[model samples]
Target chain A: MTRFRLGIEYDGGPFVGWQRQENGPSIQQCLEEAVAATVQEETHVYGAGRTDAGVHAIGQVAHVDILKEIAPARLMAALNFHLKPNPIAVTDCAVAADDFHARFSATGRAYLYRIANRRAPPVLERGHVWWVPAELDAAAMHEAAQRLVGRHDFSTFRAALCQAQSPVKSLDRLDVNRVGEEIQVIAEARSFLHHQVRNMVGTLRLAGEGKWSADDVTAALAARDRAAGGPTAPPDGLYLTRVVY
Target chain B: MTRFRLGIEYDGGPFVGWQRQENGPSIQQCLEEAVAATVQEETHVYGAGRTDAGVHAIGQVAHVDILKEIAPARLMAALNFHLKPNPIAVTDCAVAADDFHARFSATGRAYLYRIANRRAPPVLERGHVWWVPAELDAAAMHEAAQRLVGRHDFSTFRAALCQAQSPVKSLDRLDVNRVGEEIQVIAEARSFLHHQVRNMVGTLRLAGEGKWSADDVTAALAARDRAAGGPTAPPDGLYLTRVVY
Candidate 1:
């Protein structure tokens, strides 16, 4: 028996999210079914992050133990073949050590949010970006984002059903930049509270629109209340870019 | 009646090319139906470029004459509102002179081909990129692509069913460059023969793999025979990026 690590990529448009749910289809459910079909054994796969609905993942990591002695490469190919008709693909696979855990062994996580800051709605990038029809000041958004860096109480950005033990978390990086008509926000940290990145983006958007200033962002963080923050950004733009071990 | 120009963008995965056909839905058909639904009149939409199946368009131009006196913004909004449940979107709209024709008045065309030069099959980019598993040298492809630039008898790269009067055409530009894991081939011309860009891409892929040389490309163009070229690339990676008039 061997624990195998799989590097997964998927379009979240069709799935409920990364974790399994009784309400709808999930990425985990698809992968588990694919694994069962491949090895003829029921198995549970552990993922690095439990993303929300409509959120995508590029370098999502998962691990599953198999009773059949199969090569990781063969297992990956088999899983991809069975995972057909779905938009998911297993990009890479490797045999993992018994101690390695997809969720616990991870040291850092990185996310990217894409906002189509343009007058016209997104056409080519539909379902892949948050279409913000108003003009945004990317430079101002970047400046305001700096105030949210470092360890602080992020209750203003946390989700209502967050299962995290504490609201305090250290943000290693938070950058806002413009690439043509798209405004991109990149965030990296050891972990994040549910909807933390999206909530921060929603608040930062007000600064981008000339509604709020950097000082206002500082005030929101100091309040440490969910009501103090701006509206939560939609999941259409959130992408789990990477998970570092 | 007023002639209006529309800038369109669509994911071609769900269309049978850009022209209206009885086989299935097309981008042109979608626009015409939307126009009928909006202006309360049946109208014919003329397109600047007729893209193929599975080919995307980021900046496709089209024109239609409307009997209703609707503002350009209002007409655009109305058409977009009716184009729902489809991947097609009207990005921009403008009032054009009655003499202007989307097909005939167009003086320049630009196309972009995307090749995912990676080992893994696309996940998020599924149906959006041509995944090339083999290693490709973009610089070598660029070098060979230059040989096919300028005016030439491009019958070697023409399709079997092309309706152009002559195969001789001028290529304004052809560039190959790698952006991280993706290699992009950009082509510009007053107009192109059917399958010209895809044929050039297929031939360039051979050069990228060290199968063909720059001299071979020059020789192929001089042959003026469709069988002399390498092969036609799949439409998945091809995109009609711009139509300049």
Candidate 2:
């Protein structure tokens, strides 16, 4: 048996999420079916993260073990051929040791949130960007984002239905900047509870709109209650850019 | 009657072209209908340039004469409301002189061409960019592009069916630069022959791939024959970025 690690990219607009669900299609199910069709066996692929619905990915990581021996390039090509008509793509693939796990072996993950801070609605970038007709103070957002760039009990940002045992996680980086007409927020962490990055971005948006200051963000983090945090940002703008191992 | 000039933006994937074609829908037809619906009259709008099918626009200029007296903002909003569900928007609007015309009075125009130079296909920007799998030397492309800038008989790059009276138009600027994984080409001129931008871009692709040299480009321009140049690029990557009057 051979194990291969694959780098994946997806539009994420059609699927329910990364994980397999009974309700609708998923990136995981599509890959697993493709693997099964390629090797003529029941197979499944493991993903590094279970992204939410409407969340895009550029460098999502996954791993699959196959009974048949095949070159990494040939396997990737075959899998891509079977994933045809679907927006999912295997961008890169490599041989991996049997001990390598896409999820457990990961050391960090990164995400990017795109906000079109302009009056005009995005015609070409409708599904890819969050259109905020109001002007956004990206500099203010960047200043407030620095307050959340450290280890903390992120109970205030965690989703109510999060299954994680602990609310504590170390945020490695949080950056906000304006690129052209869009505001991009980049977040990096060892591991994150459900909805952590979205909640933080939503809180930072308050600062960008001149409604809150950096001190308010600090207070929300210290509160350690979900109610203290702002609303969750939409998933259309979120992209799982990379997974580190 | 008051004449108003409007700045328009659109994704040209659905239209046959900027002109009102009998085969399929056009941006001009859409705007005219929206105007008629807004003012309850048979209104027509004239455009600064007639873009080809599948070509996008960001600052396309147009002029319309309305019989009713209405504020610019209110008319813009009303037209936009009537233009619902279409991937089109009126970016700006202002009063214009009675003698002003959209096409005749235009002093300059600018276009942007996008090339996704990578292996993976673009999922989000499929129709908006030309995906070139091979490696592109943007610096070489830029170097060769300088040869085509200035007044000359651009017959080599003009479309065979171009309706222009003369091909001796001055190209003010042509620049090529790489932004991340994409290569951008910006072209500016007072006027252009049909398919001039696309043909030049197609020729530049050869320079990017080391297939053609700067001297070869100059020779093609000096030839002053349509067959002397390379193929016409797909309209997918070309965008009417700005129109100066």
Candidate 3:
């Protein structure tokens, strides 16, 4: 058996998140089916992260094992051929050691959140961005984001349905910047509590709009209560950018 | 009646084109109907450029006359409210002289052609860009593009059904550059023959792919015949970036 690591890009608008669900098609199922069709074997592909619905990805990583002896390039082509009509694509593929588990072997993950700060609604990026008509002070948001960085018990930012046992995680970086009409927030971490990034962005947004201050964000973290945090940002604006092993 | 000049932005995926075609909805129709609904009077909005189907716009200009005494900000808000559910927005509006025609008074126009130079088809930018799998030398294409940047008869690049009386037009700029995995071509002119930008991109792509040389591009221009040029690029990658008056 040969194990292959695949780099993927997808438009998550039409998906029911990454994990398989009874509601609709998932990115995982699409990729697994495509691989099964390519190798003529019912193969199961494991992903590094199971992103939520309407969340995009640029460099999502996955792994699958198959018995076929095919070149990585040819396997990529055949998988893409069968994956067509779906918005998922295996952009890169490489041979991997049998022990290289996609999820367990990951060392870090990164995410990007896009906010369109303008009076007018989005025309081209309607479903891909969060539209905030009110002006956001990115500088304030950046300052507020700093208070959430480093190791902390992020219980206030954790989702209620999160499967993780502990809320303690080390946040490597959180950056907020304004580029033209969009305000972007990028977060990197070894691992994240469910909805952690979204919760942080939501609180920073409140700070940017003058509803909260840096002190408020710090207090929320210290409170360690979900009710003390801001609302969860929409999934449409979130993107799983990369997963580093 | 007060004449207003409006700056517009739209995603052309759902529209037939800029012009009002009987087969489907057009951007022009959408704007006119929205304005009429806001002012409670039938209004006609004229655009500086009429983009084809699946062609996007970032800074399209238009002129409209309204009998209602509404401020620019209010007019923008009211028109946008009426234009809801459509991927079109009036980004800016200003009062203009009665004689300021959107089409006739334009002194220059700019367009951007985007090609995703990658192995995999674009997922996030699927409708917004053209995906080309082959590797391209953008620097070589840039050098070749400079040869077509003067006043000349652009018959080789003009569409067969172009309505321009003369093929001779001043080509101000045809700059090409590569940013990461994307190749962008920005073209500007006082006015252009139909399919002029797309035609140039198509031919330049040939040079980028090593199918044609810089000398061949010069020879095609010297020939001044439509058959001497390469094929027209798809409309999906073309964007009406700006219109200068």
Candidate 4:
């Protein structure tokens, strides 16, 4: 058996997150089904991260083990041929050693959140970005985000249903910037708690709208309670940009 | 009556085109109906350009005369409130001179065409970009595009159903550039013939794929016959980016 690494891009609007669930369809199920159809073998696929529903991914990484002797390029072509009509594409494929674990061997992950800070709702970017009518102070949001960029116990940003054993994680970067009427927030980390990025974005949005200050964000971190954090931002604005190895 | 200039944005996946077509719903009909509902009056809105079916717009400009004495901001909000559920947005609105005409008074129009040069079909940008499986030489495409720049008779590229009286039009700029796996072609002119941009892109694709050479593009241009040009590209990848007055 040969193991293969795949680079995936998907529109997560129609999916119920990456992991297979009884609730609805998932990116994992789609990939596995495509692979099964191509190789005529029922196989399981593993992804580096299981994104939430309505969360997009441009460079999601996955690994699958198959007994087929097809080349990497042909495998990519055959898989894409079967995955048609669905908003999922395997952009790249490569042979990997059996030791390469898509989830365990990953070193970092990057995320991007987009906020359209204008009166009109997004048109071309519909279902892809958050629409905030009032103008946001991106500089203030940046200042607030800087306060959380370090190794810390991010209990305030952790979701109540988060299954992670600990909230302690190292945040490598958190940046906020504005371009025209759109505000972009970029975050990077070795790992994240459930809804951690979205919760932090919600709090930064409050600072952007002048409802809260940087000190308030600091206080929320100190509170170490889920209620202390701001509301969770919708999944529409979030994108799993890349998974670094 | 006050005339207002509005900058519009829309995803063209649903609409037939920008014009009022009898076959299917059009962006013009959607916007007009939304505006009429908001102001309680019938209004004829004119757009600076009429994009084809499946062609998107990011900064399409339009003008409408309304009898209501409402502020531009309020008008924008009300129209958007009614235009909801449809992927159409009035991004900006301003009071314009009564003499302002959306089509005639426009001094420049800019368009962008995107091509995903990769083996796999696009997932995230499925409708937003054209997916070509063959390897593309962007440098060759750029060189071929330069041959079509400046004033010339673009009969080889114009659609047979084009309403323009003359095939001669000044071509201000046509630039082709590659960004990672994407190829972006930007075109600017005061006006264009129907299917001109798509036709040009189609011919350039042939050149980029080694099916045709730069000299072939020049020969096709000099032929001055629609049959001499390459196949017309689909409208999905075209975008009416901006209209400058």
Candidate 5:
């Protein structure tokens, strides 16, 4: 059996999420089905990130073991052909080491949150961006975001359903910048607690609106309670941009 | 009646075209309906350009006459509320002079055509871009695009049913640039014939593929026949970006 690593790009607006579920389709089930169709064998695909519903991914990584004797390019082409009508594309494929694990082997992961900071609602970028009607101060958001960097118990930012055993994770980078009418919040770390990025963005938006200061963000982090944090930003604007190994 | 000029943005995927038709919905019909619902009067909306089906717009200009006394921002907000679920937005609105016609008063227009030049298909931007699976030489395309930058008889690029009285239109700019994995073609002109930009892009793609050169493009332009030019590019990649008054 050969283990192949796949680079995936998907619009999560349609799927239930990354993991398999009985209520509706998920990215993992669709990918596994595509692989089964290509290799004519039941196989499991392990993903690097378990993105939530309505969350997109541009650089999602996955690994699958198959018994088919096909070229990586051929397998990728075939899988894409089968993944048709579903907004998912297998961009890259290569033979991976037998010990390679898509989740456990990943050393770093990055996320990008996009907010359309304008009075006019987004038409073309409707589902891909969070439309905040208020004019946001991106510089202030950046300044306040610096306070969240480093290791801390991110209980205020953690999701209730998060499976991570520890809430303390080291955040390597958290930067905010405005590109035209869109405000981009980029976060990088070895890993993240569930809903950490969205929770952080929601809290930073208060700072962008001049409603909260850097010291308030520091206090929220110190509180270590979800109630003290801001609301969770919608999953529509979140994108799993990269998973570094 | 007060004449109001509107700056509009829309995803043209669901519409028949900019003009009203019996077959299906149109952008003009939707905007007119929204205006009627807002002011309780039937009115006409004149657009700066008649964009084809599947073409998008970020800066499309239009005008409407209404009897209601309403602020521009309030009108814009009400129209947006009424245009719900449709991928259309009235970005800006302002009172206009009696003689300011949306179609006649426009001085210049700009269009952007995006091509995803990559092996993988676009997932997030599926309908918003044209996917070209081959590597394009953007510099070569840019070099050849310069040949079409002057006033010329463009019958070679004109559509058969184009209603323009003459095929002579001066093109101010035709530029090709590579942005990441996407090839962007920007065209600016006072006006364009039916499918002029798409035809030019189709021919330029040949140059990008190393199959044609600048001289070949000049020959095609000089032929004065649509059959001499390459096929028309898909409307999916075309976007009406700006309108200068």
Candidate 6:
């Protein structure tokens, strides 16, 4: 058996998330089908992150094992050809060690969230960004984001449906900055709870609006309750930027 | 008559160019309909540039006359409210002097062209950029682009359908740079012949691939024939970035 690691990019708008589901199409299903068509083998495609619906990815990583003796570049080309019309692309493909699991071997992950902070709605970037009509103080949001950077109980920012065994995780970075008219939030960690990035962004937006202080965010985190956090931001603005191994 | 100068932004993907046509929807038709709904009057919206289909704009300028007495901000908000779900936005509105005309009074116009220079297809920016898989030498393209700048008779780059009285126009700037995986080309001019920017870019792309030199570009310009230039780049990568009056 040959193990191949793949770098993937996709627009998650149409999928039912990264995992396979009966409700609708998924990134994994498409990828697996493409692999089957290329190698005539039914293999499971394992992704580093299961991104939610309407989210996007630029540097998502995955792995698949096939018995067929196909070259990596040839497999990538075949997969891309078979994944036609779908908004997924196999950017890079390489031979991987048998023990290198896509999920378990990932050392870090990074996510980017974009907010169009302007009175006029975004024309070109309609679905890829969360349009916030009210002006946001990006500096305030940046300051508030610093409070959630270190290791702590993130239950306040966790989703009720999250299946993570523990609420405590070390957040390597959570930075907020304004780029042109958009407020961008970048987060990095070893792993994250379901909806953690969206929840944190939603909370930071309140601080951007001057409705909450950094101390208020700390207080909310200290509450250790899902209801204590701000509303979850929509999945449209989130992007799985990178997965490191 | 109260003349209003409006700043417009649009994703030109859904329109049949800027002019109103019987074939399909147009940006002017949408903006005019929105204005009619807001002011209860049928008025003509004059634009600074008549962009082709699939061309986007961030700072497109237009002018309209309304009989109603309304504040500029209020008029802008009302127009925006009326132009819902169209991927169009009225970014700014202000009362203009009687002599001001969106098209005739414009002193300069700037356009931006984006090329996704990567092996992977763009997922998030699919419609907004041209995907060029080959590696492009941006420095070569930039050096070649300088040959097209300055006052020149641009008949080589002019479209066959161009109706301009003269082919001579002063090109103030043409700069090419690589931004991550994307190649950005910025062009500025007092006025341009139809498809001039795209045509210039198409020729410069040959330089990027090492197939043509800067001298070749100068020779193409000196030919003064539409057939001498390269193919016109698609409208998808072009944007009317700014209009100066």
Give the winner by DockQ: 4
Error (Å) of candidate 3 at residue B48 is 0.9
Per-residue error (Å), model 3, residue B166: 0.9
What count of clashes does model 2 give? 0
Local error of candidate 3 at B149, Å?
0.7
Give the per-residue lDDT digits (tens) of candidate 3, residues A57-114.
9889999999989999999999899999898888899999999999999999999999
Candidate 5 local lDDT, residue B232: 96
User: What tier of docking accuracy does candidate 2 attain?
Assistant: medium
Q: Looking at candidate 2, what is the lDDT of residue A73?
A: 85
| Candidate 6 lDDT, B1-245, residue by residue in tens | 79999999999998999999999999999999998999899999999999999899999999999998989999999989989889889999999998899999999999999999988777678889988889999999999999999999999999989999999999999999999989999999999999999999999899999999999999999999989898899898999999999
Docking class of 6: medium
The DockQ figures for the candidates are 0.62, 0.55, 0.80, 0.92, 0.84, 0.76
lDDT of 5 by residue, B50-97 (tens): 999889999999999999899999999999999988999999999999
**Candidate 6: residue A15 lDDT (0-100):** 94
Regarding lDDT, does 1 or 5 come out ahead? 5
| Candidate 4 error regions (>4 Å) | none
lDDT of each: 0.93, 0.92, 0.93, 0.93, 0.96, 0.94
Chain A TM-score values for every predicted structure, listed in order: 0.99, 0.98, 0.98, 0.99, 0.99, 0.99
TM-score of 6: 0.98
lDDT digits (tens) for residues A46-137 of candidate 2: 99989998899988999999999889988888888899778898888899999999999999999999998876677777788888878999
Query: Each candidate's iRMS in angstroms?
Result: 1.8, 1.7, 1.0, 0.7, 0.8, 1.3
lDDT of 1 by residue, B75-126 (tens): 9988888998788888889999999999999999999999999777777887
Off by over 4 Å in 3: none
* Candidate achieving higher TM-score, 2 or 3: 3
Indicate the worst ten consecutive residues by lDDT in candidate 6 chain B.
B118-127
Off by over 4 Å in 5: none
